[model samples]
Target chain A: MTINPKAKLEETQDGTVVYNFDPLIVKSHYEIDYVHSYAQDSEFFKALGRQELMGSKCKKCGYTYGTPRGHCMECGSETEWYKLPNEGKIHAFTTCYFGGEAFLNETPFHLVLVEFEGVDSLFMSRIIGVDTEDLYVGMPIRAKFRRNLKLNPTDVYFVPKA
Target chain B: MKNKGQDVYMISGGVTKFTKASPEADFRLRTKKAFDYALNDVGMTLKDIDGSVASYFSDHFQRQLMSGIMAQDYLGLTPKPSKRVEGGGATGGLSFQAGVEEVASGRMNTCVVYGFETMSHVNTWKGNEFIALASDTNFDYPIGGFYTGYYAMMATRHMHEFGTTVEQLAKVSVKNHGNALHNPYAQSPMKITVEDVRKSPMVSYPLTRLDVCAMSDGAAVAVLANEEKAFELCDNPVLIKGIGTGTDTMRLSDRPHGKVILLPNETEADYKNLKYPGVHSFRAGRSAAKEAYQSAGITDPLEELDIVELHDAYTSSEIQTYEDLGLCKYGEGGHFVEEGKADLKGKVAVNPSGGLLACGHPVGATGIMQAVFMFWQLQRTIKKHFKDDALQISNAKRGLIHSHAGTGTYVTATIMEAVK
Candidate 1:
């Protein structure tokens, strides 16, 4: 095979030459358009803005969902929004050393699944204010909401309860 | 039991060598190679195939869509009933199941099921993002939780609940890597100690870089035929005794955790320590295995099944799958591995093909590759290619193939036996 005469060649630190016939690198960025409507639990984030954790309780089955649901998954009944206790215990947790591009700056972050005293489902959020070694399952934690935040679950965090 | 349906058998299968990098090959070339290999294995050609099932997880990598048509056109198999299948990592097995059903239903006498992924063409960051697409975008992605973190959480929970140690988890990687040393198709076959695994850089806590399977480029294809056609066309065949598939909630938060306890006499502490059944166990795997065992009439898998090929994408997954597939009792997976029950010389040899952990995970190709490995083992033709005597299980009559997709959302379990 004949090599391209116009090929660009570059030398590496190890003295190895790399050839690139097509030096033009096309860069593109695209976004996935999605309409996220929190109609079921718009109040959930609104409550988080006020530093209060909230959940939905199924009036029919008495099942409480940590992340607010519009209807009961069990009986298909309308759910009632209720303020959840800020205090909960860690159901499970993991300390991530390598966070992807989105979370690269916040390396060594702790992601915990906190189960409230009465909630049926676990609430997953980042945990702060504790040594990584000290964090254990069933450790008491309290919700801490981010100030000046928009409608997102990451707006809330948990810390070791005093 | 009532009459199930027509019997289906895997007459032949083929797989390209798993590699971390294959810059020269693309999806079409890999598919054609795997297809031709499978056809040659059975002494057939494209003209003999009546139907085809192709699986490739994301067209984004290839910048193409309608992969089934693409494969069909590239293979020059015109007018053949061809379709695509996708179920995250379980796409290959799901495609195989579809092919089996197509033949069993008498719609097609012979069919080809194949899957491939050319992930090495893309950069690692882009590949990681593409893989994250399989997760629940609304919940998992926003929380900075991808596959590694998701599995790490499960590992942590398993450690807490069952006292499973990180060393025990490392033993899985050690054992799989040791098995891969004998596999010619494996990507990384170097043997390492449990201490090496623990010393490896932590991607997510409790799970190091070595614990996760490498992203690979490869393709695997299998030919399925009805009983009569299999008996007529091939001298020896691997019968597909049973196939089962099940799914769980898409989002991790919505996974079933059993019923909520409510009693007036219960203390707050009791509720705090309330243990749910489905936390560590993969419900989808359990459900699929249950159906498979029932259909195959297998009461004791550890005792009845001679060999197994499980989806060991992460070392933790393999440990958990031991419990999910009923190879051992719940919360005994760590002990199962510690006792050497899952070794090649153990009660039930698991992942004799080096598994995804050592052989490299090409996503769509993994499940089909497992079936290909099982087919070779049962047909006793594995030694021809692998040339590893220790890799072959002794008197292997029955084998099982299990694969899970998208954080336990989908599972496919297939039981295959050697036709005496």
Candidate 2:
């Protein structure tokens, strides 16, 4: 049985549709296009457009992060933008056979936690062009950037280096 | 707030049957049913409730900003102090502790903690998106970081670090779902085997569909009071021995490799090579357990705790939590499950109520349901509440209820003792 939301209820002309009667199921639609801001982390996303991964470094503790951070988590000091190497190693990964609505069409994808040599933490990203069974820990990987950027995290991903 | 030597007890409580969808009922109706059942269980009325703490996970599910207040008004808890508490999946556990604070502080004689979730309002995929919104939306969500993928990554790391086998993870599903057979309120009751679990369609690698919990709709109500008020309300009030809450970095990668917070029986040597709280373990859970055990005067949790109802949003998490709660050595969780140490007849019975795997993960109602089950278990009234003795542990003296959220960002542990 097919149900249509814009069926136009005969009893009403107020742009309403009923899916059921016993419980009176009504179809209500909601959608939004948020004008989001990256704020202080704007530089990190913008850097992806330049083929550069920008990590944050604590000025006081000399601690480094693989991902963006505005302040030092350990010393509570303000951080500065630091350039991250293009190549890194896969710390861990998993194959997601199911995902959210945004990524449902791209199901059965690989999500990896990439670790850097000098970085203190791992960075989450997708590993393209790699078979799930072929993926393993300590695998050599390099960051890949999209030619056209949208200031989104997906603009930067990881691929096998060699 | 500390207990401050003022004892608290869960005098009465009630829960609605969990299901995949309940289009006929909304959160308000569910809470009213549970609240009425709780009040009637003690032969009390709405007048007995001095205040309340409402718990639910997401406004996206209910599509109402102040759904808690709406439920409060529906319950006729008007003119009373009430506030909403949310810690993702730990909302129920946090609300229970909030009510405990109300009674223990001598502020209110009786406090009600009610929790519910109405996830059926959205499509399942959209519901996943709503839950994924709880992640670091900027970082994780953009890279196709589905919630299960995070857990799947952790499970993979656990497998790599400790050689935890897929069969071991499947054992958890088999055990938990089997226990749900006697639980009349459970959503998924199955007599499945490890092979059946392995054969189920894979959601993520190594995690079959059966290994995951269903999004459920239900509500639970727990009435708490100080000792004097507890006695006046009902007989066999279960004592709230201790309650503890802990948190970690919102992002898993941001967590530092800090030293393990040792329990009474554990030492630095137990985790000498273990890179403390890597993706393989839950550090906040251990912190919560450490504090809860201290006030409860518990030394050896594996032996001291008769039953533990924990957050098993996935089969693999149950094994990892066993290690965090000090039920086994950090890297020996797989062996613990393989040896049947967490079985119904084992040293400790974990998730005898079927946990989230079988009973379903109603988010906000899950932890309160755990406490309600523990309330009945400790009072030796499992026969009455469950209508069968299949899920009961013989001579259960004490039980621990755990609630967790995010990637172990927020965790709570509440210890309950029976009044012998």
Tell me which residue pairs clash in candidate 1: none
Candidate 1 off by > 4 Å? A1-41, A76-78, B1-3, B259-276
Task: For residues B30-137, write the lDDT of model 2, one tens digit per residue.
Answer: 999999988998998988889999999999976789999999999999989999999998899999999998888888999999999998877888888889888998
Query: All models: lDDT?
Result: 0.82, 0.90
What is the CAPRI rating of model 2's predicted complex? medium
Identify the candidate with maximal TM-score.
Answer: 2
Model 2 agreement with the true structure over A55-137: per-residue lDDT tens digits = 99999999999888999988999999999999999888999999888899999999988889989887899999999898988
Task: Give me the overall lDDT of model 1.
Answer: 0.82
lDDT of 1 by residue, B142-259 (tens): 7777778778888888898889999999999999999989999899886899999999999888899889898899999899999888987788999999987878766566555773
Error of 2 at B191 (Å): 0.8
